[model samples]
Target: MAEYDMQELTLPNEDGKRILYPRMQLYGQKDLEYIADKVSYATSFTRGDIKGLVQAITEEIAHSMSEGYSVKIEGLGVFTPSLGLRKDKERESGEEGAPRRNAASICLRDINFRVDKELLYETAGHCTLQRAQYKKCRRSSQMFAPEERLERAKEFMKKNTFMSVAEYCRLTGLLKTTAANELKAWAAQPDSGINYRGRGTHKLYVLRPANA
Candidate 1:
């Protein structure tokens, strides 16, 4: 049986009313080996064969997506490639005579997956949900004011050269999304005492240069 719990919405609505939403209580992660073993017991294929096939299929999907092709398995779904600008490449919007972006500035941002309806229905058919006790939001950011958090972040960056979003969250007790958004906002402001290096998942926050 599957279990679920209610989580309070973090954002405020127009009426300033708090609301709760249902979220599944995950047991744990099942890796490739566990999946292979399960499939082996249900079919004639050995675990090794299943693992090899799965790996090969993943590699092929990556290769095809790199070549600008979307792959769709019968029972699975479509995997489409997505692109984004590389680090230091700003969008050429409203900038007069800015250098146009070339291939070097483009990168594979992500691969979008649209699940098949049949697979979704099949998975839903197997679920038996039971409501569990509600868990309170662990937003530690509530303990500190926004300015206090910024001071703490500046202190942290003084000793460390760079800080990842996860490290910032630990330092400020903020949720991941909140920490990331705040960091981006701070980086955008002039003399905000915070700046970021790199792009996408590799991004790291650093103290803004004194002269800049």
Candidate 2:
């Protein structure tokens, strides 16, 4: 089994109660070594890793949508870009020489992103300088397991297989943390599992067949 490191962080509430959370292990040894080696290196990063990340994303989208279902990068909604040839009637000068030559086009019929409420709320808090409120909101439960939490989550999975953790929480009103842990439990089963993409702030989960 691969061991994942975890960081214990204490976030203080307005009234001073500390909320402890295990932040997912972020940087690994290779990452630390790279950062160490480049201490003096300054690279311009506009969101920084945009280009390579975008290409990787495009490849993923192409892979998933090859058969036509829309693919979504959440916060960003679904996108269905198609490659096609452009053919139109045209006459150069008045020669009436049939139509123009072949031309190709990549059409982005839908490119959209819907900001998450938590993201929006955090941004607003920062902009308004509401540090206290922001901190309190950030500590919001998105993590507790209720009385029927597991059963409810499993039932939800039955109806909406392969949903993201946030999406599942959104639909079922489960705390984000609780939903994540539930899915983690489901994954631990030898004959049932789920997979997720992204890490830290951008994580999203998907259900997989038991055999997978």
Candidate 3:
């Protein structure tokens, strides 16, 4: 009974045929409330009771995973905690051939989940699909020329006093690395009217104050 935004994408395989795929839209806590109500009506429990149970389960799952435990819900999935790789870290106080690292060296970066195969298959069978009204699009940012992108960035900096790399990408639609290189290049070109400031995460692009 639920509708999803579906869009047709061309496969780059040998057949190269277009196929409709569901575009997943994000659902929030409000959607969870609706689900709790429906579940309450189906069973004897009240909506508040269902909501409380769901919250308790979520909290418990998080607690277990934090303790380096993998939890599996009967009809759903398994959630496992994992750490991120710190490849760029220099060897700080290590032996001649060995690198010294500890638990503090890396943080718990992700909690991953694997769906239950049976539940996945059954759920997929019940879904209704519909096509999106919008046309399919490739990355339109890729269409922009370097000069055009610089002009767009200049236009953006006209109002804002400073901008982060993330902010620049959001405004100009350029990817992060692309935006960084462009901003640095402009900064190196003396008297380019655009100046880069600050270091690392505190970086910004600023307009020249006209004489000095």
Candidate 4:
């Protein structure tokens, strides 16, 4: 059985009225071990064998995706690889001063999954839903002008050698996605007084060097 709740929307409609939307309440996460245990109970194979098979399948899927192929499991789903710019490798072209995007600048960003219809239908058939509680929309009170936020980031970078997206979010009271996008935009502007180092998860914003 699954539980659902009504969550009030933070954003108002054109008539300036917020409405409630249905959302599923997550119970907990089930890891690979849990799946192995469940499968082992229903099959002649041991938990170790189930785990090994699952691991091997995951590795092969990753390998195939890296080689530009999407993998589809019979009753599960299709896994397609998505690409994005590698922050560290991106650079402005000297001619147009626009960022150059090519094979070198791009890397696998994420894997998108499209579940099989039959599997989804089977899961939906087994689900028994009950209403839980009503949730109110909670909006962030920390709102600052874009220019002010940029200045705040610059000031912080002056004292600290580097700042992570999480740190920037805490310092400016901005959401994670907003903070990350702002930082990336600032770093792209050569004279923004902000730059970045590293790539992907290890990326950090830093004060632009005076000479470079």
lDDT of 2 by residue, 1-212 (tens): 12122333466678876566433221122343344335424555433354556668888887777666668665545666454443443333445765454433333334344556666676556652211211112232444355354455455567766456655554445455755776666656644445655655445655555667
Candidate 2: residue 7 Cα off by (Å):
37
lDDT of each: 0.82, 0.50, 0.71, 0.78
Cα RMSD, model 4: 18.2
Instruction: Give the distance in Å from residue 40's predicted Cα in candidate 4 to where it truly belongs.
Output: 0.8
Number of clashing residue pairs, candidate 3: 0
Judging by TM-score against the true structure, name the best candidate: 1
TM-score of each: 0.62, 0.27, 0.49, 0.58
Superposed Cα deviation of residue 127, candidate 3 (Å): 1.5
Off by over 4 Å in 1: 94-96, 134-212
What's model 3's lDDT at 108? 81
* Angstrom error at residue 167, model 1: 30
Candidate 3, 1-212: lDDT as tens digits:
33346666766446786677777432212367788877887999998999899899999999999887999997799999988656665545666868777766777878899999988988889976554332323343565677776776677788777766655565555656667888898878766777878875457888766885
Per-prediction backbone clash count: 0, 3, 0, 0
Q: Give the TM-score of candidate 4.
A: 0.58
- Which parts of model 3 have CA positions greater than 4 angstroms off? 1-30, 85-96, 133-212
* Position 10, candidate 2: lDDT: 62
* Candidates ranked by lDDT: 1, 4, 3, 2
